[model samples]
Target chain A: MKKTCPNPAFLGFLIATAILVAIPGLSYVKQRAPETIIPGPGVTRRGSLSDYLPALKGTSADTPVFYLEGKEPGGTVLLVGGAHPNEPAGFIAPLIVVERGVAQKGRVIVVPYANGSAISHTEPLEGSPASFSLKNKAGETRVFRVGSRLSNPLDQWPDPALYVNEKGQVLSGSEMRNLNRAFPGKADGSITEQIAYAIMEIIRREKADISIDFHEASPEYTTVNAIVAHEKSLELAAEVAMYLEFDDIPITLEQSPKNLNGLSHREWGDYSDTLPFLFEAANPFMGRLRGKTDETLIIEGKDPYYLAAAKAKRLNVPYDEKGLPLSYRVARHITAFRYVLDTYNTYYEEKAIIVTDLPEYEEMAYRNLGDFLN
Target chain B: MKKRVFLLAFTLVFAILVIANGPAVPKLAEPVMITTAGQSAGAAMMKVLFTKSNIKDFVFEKLVTADEIEGYETLVIVAGASSKGLGAAGIDFDGETQRVTALIEAAKKQGMKVVVAQIEGAARRGTSSDQLFSLFVPMSDWVIIVRDADSDGFFTNLCEEHGIPLTIVEKSIEVSAQLNAVFE
Candidate 1:
């Protein structure tokens, strides 16, 4: 008569353990699924980062690349976003370009998720949401994953004590996983470095005349809402700044520090013939002073802490009750992108890039951000 | 009749104040040589503005030596220090200061007008920037600075002590209009 009763306490513990493991495990697995991106009418070809670096194929480091070629052959403009996935606007800006932009003259190459590995994971201990949702023009909900500034530890682990990049610049070990800091990367290096190599290869193989990387920083950051340009691209950057200033969009124009190597703006310019530019916009969601980090904060960008910081004159960008929303940040990037191409066309008619049908600053900034999404 | 007389007197007083307080800025000569004392991006921005203002015969060199200013009538040394810039240019503060000093001395010897400009605002105003400003301001005939750069009246005090004309602009973007005005 073997009627054995199970221990209720042990059963309870088992149930609790399963819940703890299953909850995060499910979320982690769910994030691996790529977000749906519909190529617009302008998109002529769809490729992967693996195309440039075959080693990236079937790996998390690979990301989608959208090419919009015009009828008239001209220069190739490479626009990359989501280098740091925690910056949602960076990811969204390129998405808009892929979903809406039309290249009229030159070819437009867009990489919405530059670091696919990073895009699938959020920074630990930050308490950020796994993903955020926005309603597309069709009123269907589209989901986007918010991720860490560094590549996922699951993919690239074992941070060294120090990281000496390809440029011989010494940085903290954690920066090794940072795609932005891994520029002109090593082909046989870490996953993040390999991804960076792929990006550089894209620039080289594509013969990109102009390369722009989208980024976002906290409002308190001195370089927020600024355009950091390489030395070769200074004139183009200055012209873009002039046009932006005339439009009442105040942006700081900073030359990329030559000594601070391993950045998109610095390394891209040094390694390739492409004139590199990095654009930064204010994101309260990433600010140290922000409170209640959530999807709303990522989308609306309203943070009372940032508001107080603004009052204390601690912020570089002007912040008020009408917080720096994702729409505004994305709009700034798009506008700056448009201006760069325009200015490039003016100076280098032989390598001119003309991209049209992209959303304007006023249209995107003043309207619902989701309206532009697909 | 008394109201009209009062208004006339007020108007005359206002006119006199306006004329007295107006900027009696001396015109900057043509063929300006734009250079950076500390290799900041301000010089590049100034070049853009000069082009926008339609200023003719100007040359921009990040590290223009005294020899380079042979044809230039005015040496506009934008005074702003960037440590990264210095490191990139492979020069220390002392070397930069010495280089700038030599350039200024040569400009002075050539009878070229020396204009020290600080146009990147308060962000570019620091100890090294001040050192560059101090050394060059005394030798400068004019100082074109953003208003924020002079928030502590450092430029004002330096220009006053050296009898230099200081043009403080509210914004860096407005410097183009001011540059055009001075050229006019």
Candidate 2:
């Protein structure tokens, strides 16, 4: 009997074929980073966070900051999004502003993704999709990342049994990775804290008169669809709230607690001269009661269980079958930003910040968000 | 022949042992039981009992307490009332009023506000009418009552006689809308 030898050529071909077959599946595993927003006509310059803090120069936390400056030179306002990556409305609102807003009187600096590493992963235990897409007016689909609430564990691993934040807050170990909790961060800390420190450095260096941190919360949460303002920002927040109410958006103004340390509103105010404000839009997908945590649930913001809960008077936000769509939440944030800008102008005439080309809440709601996107 | 016989006997013993252990494993414990309450018109507005941190830990035994009263500055509460069992235990209606007073005092100290909720309809569990008045009415800072066309104006007139601010919410959805208006 003759022994047959295995063909090396055939084995190599088999290996190549296996890799080719996995290419498509592996592409899905790779995160879909959002398309870069081409700054509009109002954009004066673009800079990186590393410019302020060289320590974050080559790290994933270093994000591009868009600057829109007016010739008149008035107050400077800083708008940050993606403090919590799961809240897309927080990021998209500023992204839209960067691509569309035209500054007329003062300056507006927008950081679309404050925690870039957080956008690299999805929240563990929540089976959420990594990305979702929206169709622009020209029929081109624009994809955006649906990221985790905290920094990727790969970058910062083995959480302490309990994380005592810089503010001395004892929270779950995982919260140490949360950028929102790492505000006024230490320069020589973890990656998340370093990113936060970079942001604080930027605010202080810029002498930002006002800062707004955007976020979203579950509809079942009591603080949803509200503005949480630091004590110093109360008068401005009240004016914005009143204006929003008149516009029929119905936003509640909440005073930030003094004792809640490390929060963007609390720390930014305590550490810097900038008046800090945080906005929360209701997101049903983030709710504990939601079912089938997927991109549809995220973008469409619909859930049968939430509707039932709403009917039973258990939810904080109004839940109809129509659901709280992405466009509505984005519109809410955009409208609140406009109101805050207007309020800022009224309070400080010498340093008035005025911007145009931003859509009103109803206009955005009717035209849909894609109409505004570049 | 002896070696072949030994091998056959070992195979037979292995097969018997495998068959004795079944594939399906038995459960260790019974499943937990959960109870869900049916939806009612009054469900829209929860009659949350507001107590100071010390008393709240004891009084609002089963109800969820708002983290801070400022969370619900516009919330309405009915005052001078206790739960049925609580009222019958000689927790005086006057004592309930003092508790509400203490809560208001503490709220002011914390730079918060309080709203008194009124009860619209009486809940009847048994022959004791005090359960209806003691449990739901006086404890809320604000009162909301349900009045049908057949009530002969009894509940409405009584609420008005006490100078309580009352609103008639006929349907469950209406109650929700009204509560949203107050809280939002």
Candidate 3:
């Protein structure tokens, strides 16, 4: 008499909740597996970042490294893209470098996904697209993943109330997982720190003379379309700006603040002999003024809200009906990269860094970005 | 004793003559620093395109004065208007135009070789930037314009009509080797 069945209505509610929850959680788990990255003709050798720092081995943070070495030996350059995974141009720039770059007389080492764990997820509640598609030269569409700004808490969880980095610079708790802020890292530290440490190891092991961190910024940010360089890298950064400007790429130069701690440009300059430079391309999609966050905003970069802001004279960089597409941004980074090496070669005659076979800025902008991809 | 005294006197006189006339200094092609007369972004572009050349490319984004141009072997004026740039410099459009025009006039007065460049494409060929272009193109001894502008033969015809040596580059950077040739 005391054995009574539970309410069917309550069971029905429980089943509905479980079904709703399972669909999204399962999708998230499926997306956690890393996406495929195809190496191009330029990639002569490939390895994981863990090769430099074995601590990253068998971990979610280990990422791929594509190296392009020329027939003639010369200086080596390290290009780090996707430092912040939300920035698509930053990721695409290094991808293009690996896929299309021809090492003229020097070596170009590219890491398109510097933060392996970060790429597996998107920013929560942003309504961001998981990936965007581009038609390659053969007219076959290729997909690239878009991810969050920080390492997935699944990899590095429980952010401290305050994140005092290796250099004692206090940042918001979540910055503990920001690759840009964790650079020049400790080997046995958290996953983000280990990834950063691996990158520094790449610079040390490869003897990279120049290291560039690609980034993007809100159109309203004053530093948009600018190069933030270490004091030692001022000359190269300035030259790169002028070079891009000549191509109508609209580059400006900004010296990295000496006091800023735990930044890629600052830490790389302090910890190694490498000249470090960071670039911020203007992306209206990342701006607070953006409207309708979607794949089109990420790839095409056309936003009506930004156009209004431009008309109101509110943006730092130039914005018009044409919009700041991913092609334009990638072209800017490539042009700067070419000229920085050119100027570096001029100053250091023995260390002539020449990389060729990459698509030019005008062609990428006018023709199609997919034309150069494998 | 008399021969030695005469030899000493001859040597002393030769030394005096050499000291008074100064030593024969070898001439070298020195570097020339480049700066914008009105803080135009185009000047920065010109400097980049002029790299690896004997042009002695230096970019000074401030208003380049006649005093600074006195010793330059060649002066390159990148004629494009950036009102935003001028505004940042705390100067109005009229003032910047006058300052640029005066700097070029002064370079000419000093007999410094002048090459006016407007390699920026159609986007830079707007109203105010056009006025800046016109002010110096005719006055310059040589002209360098990007082929983008010469599609309709506007700049080439202008150069021909003004008897200025005109060069049309497929891309702006192509003009670097040719510019180095000019310096040579």
- Model 3 over residues A275-350: C-alpha lDDT tens digits? 9999899998788889899888877889999999988967777899989998988888887787788779878878
For every candidate, C-alpha RMSD to the true structure in Å: 7.0, 21.9, 13.3
How well is each residue in A158-276 modelled by candidate 1, as lDDT tens digits?
99999999989899999999999998998899999999999999999989999999999988776778888899999889778756765667676778888888999999999999999
Rank by DockQ, highest first: 1, 3, 2
Reference-based lDDT, each prediction: 0.84, 0.66, 0.76
1 or 3, greater by TM-score: 1
Chain A TM per candidate, in order of listing: 0.97, 0.93, 0.95
Q: Which stretches of candidate 3 lie over 4 Å from their true place?
A: A1-11, B1-184
lDDT of 3 at A12: 98
- Write down the C-alpha DockQ for each prediction: 0.28, 0.02, 0.07
Best candidate, DockQ: 1
Ranking by TM-score: 1, 3, 2
Give the TM-scores of the predictions, in the order they appear.
0.88, 0.69, 0.69
Runs in model 1 lying further than 4 Å from the true structure: A1-3, B1-23, B66-71, B92-98, B121-139, B145-163, B166-184
Task: Tell me candidate 2's TM-score on chain B.
Answer: 0.38
Cα deviation of B50 in candidate 3 (Å)? 12
- 10 residues in a row with least lDDT, candidate 3 chain A: A250-259
